[model samples]
Each structure stands twice: as structure tokens, then as C-alpha cells.
Target: MAENSSSTPPGTPPEDSRPRPQYGELAPEGWSWTPTPDERTLATPDAPVSSAAPVAAPHPRGTAPRWDRPVTLSLLVLGLLSTLFAVSMLAMITDSIQLIYTQLDLGGYEPDPSVPGLVTAGIVSVCLVWLATAAGAILLLARGRRAFYVPLIGAVLFVVVFIAFSSAVLATDPTLLNDPNLMDVYGSL
Candidate 1:
């Protein structure tokens, strides 16, 4: 028996097959490798695709493809810097709890309170969202996507997330509402 060119080998699937998405990954499960209608065609019958063909780029090249313009590179650098800052804040979250307790002590509050998981959850969630935002923007930047609005959208998302988490933190903690001193500190924050 003879095999047609269209027949995949018995032992292995073709390289063009779609992959299963990971848990929490942005790609939807069951997504196929087939190119979407919105995407540009990779190759033409007249010309085969080469390694450089992808980066050779079209005009404006959508967002900030590095080879096409300096803006993407600039955004990459800024995103990295902001990532570092956000990571530092995440690193310092534990210390902030100690500081919060100390302030409560200075205000003549009695015994030390064990840290609240709600507050911790809120803080960590906010930081993780921030990191995720930066990471998403960076990923888009690397992929040569038209991603100028990704970071902008991420910033807005951060504020909204912060507000939601902050409200939860406040609402759950009665001490913040009962004591004027704690309220002042929370308000300052």
C-alpha cells in the first residue's frame, strides 16, 4: 500500500497540530493550531518563509515589533523597570504588616494581633495582578503584537483591583472602622 502526501505518519502527528493549553493560561482550551482569519498569512506559494521573514515586518508592524521601531524596545525597558518596582513592593508586604502593628501599638492598642489572612490575600492578590499585568504586556511586546493599549488597560485594571481589594480589607477589619487612629492610618494609605 502507498501513502498519500496528506497522510500523517502512523507513529507521530504533524508538527502543525494545536497544543493543549495549560492551567490558567491565556490561550483557550481546545484552540487549534490553524491560523485565525484576522492573522496574516505566513507564506505565499511564490515565496517560502524564512527565519527572518516574521521579523521582516509590515509597515508600522501593528504594535512595537522591535525590528520595526524603537518604541517597543523602550516599552520593554520601562515594563522591566516597573516590574522590578512591583516585585519590590511584593517583597515588602510582610514588613508592612509589622509596621502596621507597630503603629497600632504606638496608639496604645493592647496585645499584638496575628496578621489577618484577608489583608494578606488582598495585598498578594493586588501584587500578583500587577505582576500579571506587566507580564502580559511584556509577552505581547515580545510577540510583536499591536499591544500599545495592553499596559494602559493593565494600569486601569490595577486601580480597579486595588480598590476592590482595599474595600474588602477595610470592610472585613472592624478595627479600621472602630478606632480613629487606625482609621486615620488606613485613610492615609
Candidate 2:
């Protein structure tokens, strides 16, 4: 059997006779068919689509794409720097603790029974906690997750620790504030 060129398949019209939408016309309600680039090219008689058209790789569900932009790069860098800084602060804290003990043992220096040891312990504990927080932030960035919130939390913790320690020191001995060296550091006695 031979098919007639003039006869179209049921529900389909000849290509040239199909209605063309005007520039600002609204599409029909309930079903709007927007052709993809490949489909458009295939439909055009003169423009045959090549078999080598590029296909985008499908992403795995539940995971967001890792951005290669400057903002993400800078965030990773900041996380690394924060981790390094925390490590350095931890080292400094250890040194401060050692120096305090050394002075008491070798320099014949006597601090108040409970205050100096308590202050030293507090400083060491705060540094260790901050170090852990910074490490966690770095890990989150490495895993392609948002990480700056961790460091922000650490900063707020630092503020609280500073205020607590400063108040404690002042309560123990307000005379330290009267010293000219400390006054220069603090801007007021």
C-alpha cells in the first residue's frame, strides 16, 4: 500500500499549514508545549540535528553542586586560615600555661591561692574549644557544605569568654586595672 503525500496522520497537520503564534499571543490554556532546542532543530526541514549533540550529565539526588566561583574559594580559604589560627592560639595557650607554672616554681613567685590557677585553666579550656570549632568548620567546607556559621558561633563564644574572664579578673583584683601598662592596653583604668 502507498501513503498519499497530501494526507496527514490523525491529530497532526501538514507542517506548512500549522498555525504560527504571533509575537505577543497567549498560549492555549491547560497544555502549553515549548519545544526544546533539539526538537526545534529536528522539526526544521533544512536543519538536521547531528547525532553528536552534547548531553549534560545528570546530578545525584540530595546533593547540591559544588560551586567553582570566587565566593566558595574564598570561604574555603577562610576556613583553612581559621583552622591555622586556632592551632596557633592553642600553642600560645600551652606556652602561657607553662610560663605561669615555671614562674611559680623557679622564680619564687606566689600568686593568690585560687585565682591565678583558675584563670590559667579557663584560658586553656577556651583555646581548646575554639580549636575544635575551627576544625569542624574546615571539615564542613571540605565536604562542600556551608561552614561560616561554625566560625561565627566560635566568635560569639570568644566574646562571651572574654567578658567572663575580664569580669572575673576585675572581681579578684581591681588594682591590676590601675597599673599604667594595663591602662594603656585598655584605654581607661
Candidate 3:
């Protein structure tokens, strides 16, 4: 009925005969292993440890700015400016039309029916270009779509082409280009 007093379990070598751990002596009963500050604390002994915190996954960079931010505000302002340009272009077309109509009423000049058709076509084309540009701006501002660049470039090219065409057409018909009466009407608007 007596309790055993031996340090080693039955069949194991005696405590004095076993090799000692290199770093520390055998701990007393109920002693548990714990890591030092220099050593990483691990959820479990078998878990991997590092001197520093686990590497946080890198976040993506160069994301588009939010709507409430400065970039978005700039785009909105540009869009408003574009809208104003479009409106001014429309007003110019209207003034041009009114000038032609007034000239026809006075019988001082006869209208070339072809002029109206060509002017109408030009205005329509310009309007289409402006619309496409506005759409591209919206897409760029809202969704950060790089595809908007294509339409934006096209719109710019269209504007250049329109100016060149208008200049050429006006140059060929000096009366249409130099009419002081028409210039006055458009200038008034």
C-alpha cells in the first residue's frame, strides 16, 4: 500500500543517469513551457512562429478615387464646363440659322438650299460628338473605365475635323464667310 518514490517511470533510466537538456535543467513537476518576448508567442507549440507579426497581405494600389473626393469633384467640374461648351455651340448654330432666315426674308440674298442641309448635318455631327464626349467623361468619373479614353480621343478628333471642314467650306464661299449681316447676328447672340 506504500507509494512509489522513484523519479523515473518504471523501465526508464534513473534521473541522474539521463542526459540533461543543454539550455536548462529539467523543470519541477507541473512546470509548463512558455516563450520569451524575443521568441514569437504561438497558439500552439506546433504552430509556426516569427520574430515579427505575420506579413499582412499587401493591398492593391492606384484604385480610383471615391465620388466625394477631390478627383471626382474635378471631373464633375470639367463635365459642367463641357456642358457649357455644348450649349454655346448649340446657340451659335441657332444664331447662324436665324441669320440665314432673316437674309432670305429681306430678299437681299437668296438662300442656297444646299447650305441649310450642310449646316444641319454639321451641327448634328457636332452634337453627336459632344454627347459621346460627355458619356466618356461620365464613365471615367463614375467607374474609372479606361475604355472612356477611346471615346474621348474620338471626340477631340471630331472637333478638329469639324473646325477644319468649316474653315474650308467658308473659305470657298467668301460671301457666306464675310457677310457682315450674318456676323452681326451671330455676334449679337
* lDDT per residue (tens digit) for residues 1-189 in model 1: 444556776767445545644453756677645546654354334566576636554656445544433554455456556645654554454465446767777443232233355445656765676567667766876666766566566667666765664555445445535666876666664
Model 1 alpha-carbon drift over 4 Å, by segment: 1-115, 178-189
Residue pairs in clash, model 2: none
**How well does each candidate superpose onto the true structure, as a TM-score?**
0.40, 0.40, 0.40
lDDT for each of the candidates? 0.56, 0.56, 0.55
The residue-by-residue lDDT of candidate 3 on 60-166, one tens digit each, is 45344343235444544554566456545543653554566566453334435455565566666666665666566666655543343544465566667567545
What is the TM-score (0 to 1) of candidate 1? 0.40
Best by lDDT: 1
TM-score of 3: 0.40
- Runs in model 2 deviating more than 4 A are 1-111, 174-189
TM-score of 2: 0.40
Q: Model 2, range 1-189, lDDT digits (tens) per residue? A: 455666877777546544676543656667567789998988778855669977666656533354523344464456456545544553354354445445434333333466556566556656665676668766766666666567667667765765565456445543342335544444663
- Return whichever of 1 and 3 wins on TM-score: 1
The residue pairs found clashing in candidate 1 are 63-146
